[model samples]
Structures are given as C-alpha cells and as structure tokens.
Target chain A: MVYYISFILIGIGIYGILTQKNLFKFLVSLTIIDTAINIFIISLGYIEGKDVPIYSKYTPVANFVDPLPQALVLTAIVIGVGTLALGASLLVRVYEKYETLEVEEIAVKEARK
Target chain B: MTIATIFVGILMIISAIYAIEAKKMLDSFISLSLLSLLSVFLFVIMKAPDVAITEASVGAGLTTAVLILALRRIGGDEE
Candidate 1:
C-alpha cells in the first residue's frame, strides 16, 4: 500500500512539473508530492507489538520498533524546510527580475536577454 | 475492521485524486494535506502510532507551512 501510494504521488509531482506554468504553483505541487513519499518511507518500517526505540526500562532493545525510519524522516523534514525556504527566496528573486510569475514568460524574457 | 480499512482506503484514493486533479494550487495543496492526514489514520489503523504522529506533524504541519510559504511567494492565482 505504501509503495503504491508513494508512486502515485511521484507521478502526480512529475505531471505538475511537466505541465505547470506558474513557478510557485509548481513548487507547491512538488512539495506535496515529496511529502507523500516521505510518509510512505516512514510507514514502511512500522512494526506492531513493539515499543519505541527510546532507551528506557519499559522498552527492551530486543523488541524495539525500527528507529532508522524516524531518524531518516527527521533528516528529511530538515532538508524539506531548507529547500522550501530556498525555493521561496529564489521565486521572489525570479518574480522581481522577470516581473511575472509565468514560467513561459520568464523563459522568454531570459532568452531575449 | 477490514470494511473500515477498505472504506478509508477509498477515501485515501479520493484524496489522492483530489490532490492531483485540483486546478487551483491552493486547492491542490489542501487536498495534499487531507491525503496525508488520511494516511496517518491509515497508519493508526495499521497499528503504527509513532508513524501517525510523525505524519500528522511533519507531513501535515511542516509540509503545509512550506507549501503556504511557497504560495505567498507566487502571489495571486492566474487563469
């Protein structure tokens, strides 16, 4: 289920990137798509009847739920934050220089210059 | 219950479709948030509370923040 849904999201993101003409809109769609996959990755490692991998007397190490996925998701969340900020700043710059948000218009303007 | 899972699965599918097919960027963004939340429900039913929490927080909250920030940068919608 995770694999299938994740792939569907990737396809949607690809479609957005391929078809979207608004630069910021494209970025929003892309982020949605990226998030879907990240959730999928976390879902993959889920194990029932096990405790969180936190070190404590309640949870025995032998019965710990997979900790790796949590760690990876943490990293992904940070990276996503950074990428989103950078994308937004670049988008602002793009809008300022081109004076329009349309990707085609921006490309045309750049080419003419 | 399997029936509920199947029903939730249907909702998940619908949300996924909405996320992809929405014409407005904001609509699509909202749909995406809905889908992730539904997936968290799915995770809970599948017996993964930690995943549900993470998905609800990072997947829905943080991701929504990123999308909204990106949208603000884009400004008003176009035809």
Candidate 2:
C-alpha cells in the first residue's frame, strides 16, 4: 500500500515535471519526487509488528525494526534539502538570465540569441 | 495503525497532485508544505520517531522556508 502511494507520487511528480511551464513548479516537482523516494526507502524497513530501533530496559532487543533504512533516510533527507536549495538557486539564476520563468519563453529567447 | 497509514498516504497523494496543479504559485507552495507535514505524520505512524522528527524539522520547516525565499526572489507573479 505504501509502495503504491509512493509510486503514484512519483508519477505525479513526473507529470508535473513534464507539463509545468514555470521553473519554480519544476523545482517543486523535483522535491515531490525526492520526498516520494524517501517514503519508499523508509517503508522498505517497516515490519508489521516491531518496535522502533531504539533500545530500552523494557523492550526486547530482537523486536526492534530495521535500523539501516532509517539511517539511510536521514542522509537522504539532508541530501534532498541540499538538492532543493541548489535547484532553487539555479532557478533564480535562470530567471535572471532569461528574464522569465516560463519554459517556452526561455526557449524562444534562447533561439533568438 | 495500518488504517491510519493508509489514510495519511492518501492525503499525501492528494496534496502532491494539488501542488502540481494549483493555478497560484503560492497555493502550490502551501500544498507542497502540507505534503511534507503529512509525510511526517506517516513516519510517526510507521513507528519511526527519529525519522519523523527529522522530517518535521527539515522537510516541513526548512524546505518551506527555502521555497518561499526562492519564490520571493523570483517574484510570485505567475502567468
């Protein structure tokens, strides 16, 4: 079920990437894809009836969920943020260069040059 | 727990679609933030408190700020 949701989100993001004309919308789509991938990765480690990976005196050690995916997702979240910041900065530069955020307008401006 | 997970997943999908389709750029931006918040809730429902915290702080908070700043810099007039 979670897998299906992520897949749908990925599809939506791709659709947005392909169809949206605005540069900012393009970045938003990319962010959506990043988030969906993170959800999918985290879902990979989930078990139906397991405790969180944290250990405590009362919790059995063997009952903990997989910790590796959580660790990987921590890195992924940071990377996603970095990617978003980079993309946003690039979009700002693109707007400055092209004088517009619309993809069609930018392409036409490029062709005239 | 399974039911709650499914519910949040559905909401996330809705917000993602709205984020893509909204006419106003700010509306799309808010929808994207809502999607991040729902993901945080879903993370908690999955029993991953640490991931939830990270996502809440970084994904929902920082990402929104970045997007807003970028939007402001670019001017929010969408045609």
Candidate 2 lDDT, B23-75, residue by residue in tens? 98888988999998999887876678888898899877899999889988988
**DockQ (0 to 1) for model 1:** 0.33
DockQ of each: 0.33, 0.81
User: For residues B1-79, could you state the per-residue lDDT of candidate 1 as single tens digits?
Assistant: 5567566666766776666666776787687778778777766654456656867787688777777776676575545
Question: What's the lDDT for residue B2 in model 2?
Answer: 70
How does chain A of candidate 2 score by TM-score against the true chain A? Answer: 0.94
**Which residue ranges in model 1 land beyond 4 Å of their true spot?**
A48-62, B1-10, B43-51
Q: What is the lDDT of residue A65 in candidate 2?
A: 77
Clashing pairs in 1: none
lDDT of each: 0.70, 0.88
